[model samples]
Target: MVATEVGDKRVDYIPGNSSIRLVDFPLKDASFRSRRLLQLALATIPWAEKSQYLLFPSIYELEPQAIDVLRQELSIPIYTIGPTIPYLSHNQVVSTNHDYINWLDNQPLGSVLYVSQGSFLSVSSEQIDEIANGLRESGVRFLWVMRGESSNWKNICGDKGFVLPWCDQLKVLMHSAIGGFWSHCGWNSTREGLFCGVPFLTFPIMMDQPLNSKYIVEDWKVGWRVEKEVKETVLIRRDEIARLVRRFMDLDDYEVKEMRKRARELQQVCQSSIASGGSSENNMEEFLGHILHGAKP
Candidate 1:
């Protein structure tokens, strides 16, 4: 979906390149070493042909142009049954002790920011300190989703922000007080953000995150990416983090206003696509019919 320089292959993903990646499925050539896994995948290549079709949780509204390109190139029938979040009953999956909805109630409309890295991908201690301090300095009311307790946050996050081990992210995103998202740009999280019409303050960690960030900032014009220097090592200073956070949180900025407008428009489209008689809903119904009965979709 990113409008980066095109190569001869005419496909977004390069088989061996680390540039296009998912967290767990490290491609054949990545910066990190995993020779054994690569060998195992190579061994399994011949057996992969037995699979019938590739199912994706990607709705057409988000990337109709890209999906059109994919449909023309691929042999298999691809079903875009997505924005799958609404189908999930959070109560059935897990329960939370905290009432974030009440917390959100106290804040002004579109005033707070939500910060989270998904369940996987660990941020270093130093990076955590930087992020916490940056948010603190930004003076923005934020709810940070952290998996475990950390001593560094005790002094850093005062009354300005609330920290939770885990929460129903979709519920939090849907709240009225949420103005922006500081996300790792995981695909699911990306969809949720879009569905809620919240603009992003992207802090991509690894894998598809970079590409997701590219799409958010460049393709969609719904967010800004935090700057980082990558040579022998990746470095993002606390000052830069603070700067980006403050800029994104500034409600008066014209650019930020435009982003919010675009996000809201996209959010409506996404919600409509999953509703009754919507494109994604119809597609999902057809897919199930094809599976459960011998019906053509």
Candidate 2:
């Protein structure tokens, strides 16, 4: 199917959306098991149609074309009430002072790189080792959120950065010290990164990640890909990783400056969407009104 759609390097089109390409489809190169899972998940689409309303946890401005297409195709009223990642909670003060928050407090503005792969899947041990050594070699300040084996990573990373099992990811992204995000391109992570206005170093692992990476690098133009190719067997060496990290963190570079500008622009858009009289706010109010009245549109 991929071959038929992407024949001879020609541009491939998605089924309904013309602005997005088939090559950027989430299931383009999915494994057999992943494909089966996707097939099973698709069964919910018809089920959704049976309902009176369909609500998407996504910002309408970010995907206007796709949202419009869905509204046209679906019979029920569709609402986009998104940026639903608990970003507003950043305003709530917590009583406890965590070590990571204190660590971020001391760092220079736009100097630290925040690294996190998704919780569902991760890169190989060898790749992790390379990333650890590379970050140390780059001489850049980083705060990495890892799940396991913190002691070993600390030994590899030395004193240049902090590696913890977990942190308040949205809070970390909102920190003034955070310069860029090294991510696995999970949908939630992607949304948070965009909301925070942070440039990205995309290292997608599987599932919808590659497509998210494409949007970050190609469509959004706010990030660069850490791995140039999609081949799992090919390892990105430590030296190359160091070079990329160093360049990505360099604030003086003209290209990096432009990317940062774009990132800030996107952040403004996200903030506006959730504000009063904004697109998301209006949609949410409409949805609430419908529910309260128990009336069909």
Candidate that would win on TM-score: 2
Q: What is the Cα-based lDDT of residue 27 in candidate 1?
A: 38
lDDT of each: 0.74, 0.84
Error of 1 at 62 (Å): 1.6
Give per-model CA RMSD.
5.6, 2.8
lDDT of 1 by residue, 1-297 (tens): 121222111334743222422322333125343455456758875643544555568778777766776667566566787788764443533343456767877899899999998887766778888888888888889999887884347568878798878777887887778999989898999999998899998877656676777678867889987754322244567877888888888899999999999999998888888889998888887778788997643
Error of 1 at 198 (Å): 1.1
Error of 2 at 11 (Å): 4.6
What is the C-alpha local distance difference test score of candidate 2? 0.84
Q: Show the colliding residue pairs in model 1.
A: none
lDDT tens per residue, model 2, 22-128: 54465665578768767877878789878888888788888787788888888788888888877644444132388988888889999999999978888889999
Off by over 4 Å in 1: 1-49, 87-97, 150-152, 228-231
The TM-scores, one per candidate, come to 0.80, 0.90
Candidate 1 worst ten-residue window by lDDT: 1-10
